[model samples]
Target: MIQLKSLQRVNPRDVEAPKKFYVQAVGAGKTDLDRLAYLISNQSTVRKPDCYAVLEALLHNMMDELREGRIIELGNIGNFQIGVSSDAVDTEEEVTSNLVRKAKISFRPAKALRDLLQTVNYKKVS
Candidate 1:
């Protein structure tokens, strides 16, 4: 068996304060890059990757489209549809009703990442 590094736990104070800052101060919605930055900053020490900027831009763009009530599909990842919950139906007949009022985001991981995770083994611990 192989042993990987144990994941570090996060402090709720660290998590919630930045989310509040992003929503209140930046006004860029609840789940924006600022919030993501706060989360990522807590995880890793070295944080000067240019790829992070690109990822943030892409995420913002996706969020913008979702805000406009469009499904944004990323290649390899499943589609994201925004919507809300409707009242429970009390009829025997099947009825289609629209009750979506807010944006909801969902993600499906890429096949490549899934496959890699399924097949790779971590180095054995001494």
Candidate 2:
């Protein structure tokens, strides 16, 4: 289930237009690694400690692989790859690592994740 809140927002393309109410998602809370491990443990024979260890190892390995310029794909979860924003240069020789302004990990959700959203139920809140 998801929670939604209504807010008045101006149209960026037409600032002179009157603000209108639009629904946006609001945080319902959060689930951490501990809670996830506990839930996974309950659903299978694996213990919570073991689950936590596996999750931690997954994080470490994923980071190592991503730093090596490899895309990390977790089955139905999604794929993560490093993306960058660089300063434009006039000459090809001027383009170098120094030109990179920022690097960020981008995630592309898998079909399974996108399908899950179709089944979501929402409740409007003030």
lDDT of 1 by residue, 1-126 (tens): 235443334457676443321111122236756556666767877363544686778888988998888888777766777757665667747445553444346666668657767775555322
Error of 1 at 98 (Å): 9.2
Query: What TM-score, computed on C-alpha atoms, does each candidate reach?
Result: 0.40, 0.91
How many clashes show up per model? 0, 0
**lDDT string, candidate 2, 28-115, tens digits:** 8899889989999999999999999999899999999999999999999999999999999999989999999999999999999999
The per-residue C-alpha lDDT of model 2 at residue 49 equals: 100
- Candidate 2 has a TM-score of 0.91
Instruction: Give the runs in model 2 whose Cα sits over 4 Å from its true position.
Output: none
- Evaluated against the true structure, the overall lDDT of model 2 is 0.95
